[model samples]
Target chain A: MIVLVDYKAGNLTSVQLALAEVGHESVISSDPSVISAADRLVFPGVGAAGSAMEEVNRLGLAPVLKDFVATGKPFLGICVGCQIILDWSLEDGRTACLGLIPGGTEIFTPGPGSKVPHMGWNHVGFYRPHPLFEGIPDRSHFYYVHSYYPTPSDHADVLAESDYAGVRFAAILGRKNLAAVQFHVEKSGAHGLRLLKNFCAWDGGC
Target chain B: MLTKRVIVCLDVRNGKVTKGVKFAGNVDLGDPVEMGAQYYRDGVDELVFYDIMASAEKRPIDIAMVRAVARKVFIPFSVGGGIRNLEDMREVLLAGAEKVSVNSLAVQNPDIISQGARAFGKQCIVLGMDAKRSDAPGLPSGYEVYVQGGRKAMGIDAVDWARRAVSLGAGEICVNSIDADGTKSGYELKLTRLIADAVEVPVIASGGAGTPAHLVDVFREGRADAGLVASMVHYGTYSLPSIKSALATAGIPVRSVP
Candidate 1:
């Protein structure tokens, strides 16, 4: 079963619904035990970084997540969930992150004729081979809604990239059993569903 | 590169998709969730849900409906109309909405934008503006801002209001043209360009979209990040796949169907 970490930051119903649509059984909870025991874990978020981290700390899921990652179980992070895995975030000033991956999150500054927030659907170009993007075509568009992005310390972890404001930022990252996409695969239409399906059927042997 | 977006909006009222010509006469289309899901399956980028009756009812957004749509639709969805305060925004976000859009409420209480941004992050707060050309002197169409689904006009310049909204933490802006809504003619290019140039946030040019060419024109000529339309897509006037194809052909990069 896939365990979806719920921190009361934003709705997890869409993620749950997407999992269901792809024929995967998942449970939504903040309980560390469920996360530690599940075959795979998904951290979904859609809010501020500081507050979301606060919930993770409040629920005592931080250490549990770290342990889970250490176990090499397949892990996935979406949006702010992806950002929280970084070393830190510069949103509303600097704040510590999960430290699962190196680097930090920084606000996007769109150049001339560019727009902030980078809302709507944008293409995701794969940079590295990973099980998470098995069926997802290269340059496939995914729904994105965020103002900050992760700059992975290890370029080897970079899995995909997307362009915005004249800067091509890292859009997907993965190393070993851990993987994540900054875009909302849950909301990326059929191609997105395929990504989730790939995750469910992946045999990463974590 | 970030591809331009072609969005099909569903202005839902009484659970049915409805569209008003020039934001005036209302006509029913079909089921909101079904139509929305169809668009999703057709390769549309994103979807917007505006409860046309929310302000009149003076209530929060329709959480149950949001939940229903959010259940079947996996793409990012945004909810607008009657989003007055943080509580309202929180409820909808909890109900599965990725973003909550505010118009009159944000105008009435500008701090709500910053507060929502502070709590949820700037990306989750979207400021919507209904604009029209004013005939007054020293002002471009007066650029008067309208509220309550374009029923009441606020004598504020549209350009200045957009600038202020961005400063207040609005990550994106949806500039709806009251003069061009449901016209099927095209988007208000001049108006969209002015607002897009004024704000650094992503501007979605809404109202008066009829064909694929219209979407192309707005994204290319107007330099809009996205185009929002309702009636045409709901009534089967244009299919999502054809639109994306046309956009691609026009040299506007779009995500091709898998």
Candidate 2:
């Protein structure tokens, strides 16, 4: 069974429905036992990082998520869920993240002509091929709505890259048994659905 | 580059999508769920549904309708109209809409913007500003903010309200021109550019898109980050692909139809 962790951060309904669209059924669960029992974890979230972190800690999902990732079943993180897994984030007055990834998150300070929120459809340029990106073409456009992005310290950890505000940032990242994407696959139209479909079948290998 | 978005607006009334000329003499369209799914399949970047009469009626938005649309459409969609408080926004988001837009309630109580932003991430909060061209006194940019489905002018400057709402935590702004709505001539370029330049967040130009070229005009000359359409596609005048092709031919960056 696939479980979409509920951290009270953002709506997981679209994620669940998207999974259903791809012929995969999933449940939204914050309960540790249910999370641990699930075969895969789809961590999808949006909203403030600090508050999202607070909710995770409040729900005591940190360790369960950590232990689940160690099992190597299949885990995918989207948006805030992707950013929060990093070591730290500069948002919400410098919030410390789950530290699953190498580095921290920083705000987008792109030069003039670039919006602060950096909201819209942008290109995700894949740096290296992986099973999660199986059928998705390179440099595919995905819907993005975030002011900050994950900046992994190790370049090898980067799965895909996308640019905004004149600065290219890691748009997709991966470590052992876990994968993360900075865009909302559920909202990215057909390609987004295709990526979600791929993730559903991914075995967490590069 | 972050390509400009092409969003379709469905003015839903009593579960059916409706469109009118300048917010009057409405015509009933088909089901919101069916139309929303069709547009999604046709390659729209996003969708926005406004409950045309909910604010004046003083009731909650139709969650059943939202859920109905959510089940069929997989892309990002924002729901507006009749949203009163944080709970309304929460309900819509939980029902599967990506963002909850506030218009009348936002004008009546500005705090709802900040409150909604805090409760749901700013990314989930959209400020739906309905404005009309007015040379009225105290109105800057020659436009005044209108609420209650564009029936009442708030005497507040549209540009000022847009900037203020962003400061209070509006992730995005959808500027709809009442004068250009349903005209099928073109968008209100002056008003769209004014608000787009004022706010740092992405600004969507809503109302008055008759042809694909009209969208190109808004994206280029109006400096809009996105263009919102109602009549052109809803009435079967244009398809999403044709409109996107026009934008692409104009040398403006836009996502190709997949």
Best by TM-score: 2
Return the DockQ of model 1: 0.70
CAPRI tier for the interface of model 2: high
> Mind listing the fnat for each candidate?
0.83, 0.80
The number of clashing residue pairs in model 1 is: 3
DockQ of each: 0.70, 0.80
Residues A80-151 of candidate 2: C-alpha lDDT, one tens digit per residue: 998999989899888988988879898998455688788888988989878887788898899998999899
Q: Which ten residues in a row have the lowest lDDT in candidate 1 chain A?
A: A197-206
> Where does candidate 2 clash, by residue pair?
none
Residue-level error in angstroms, candidate 2, position A26:
1.1
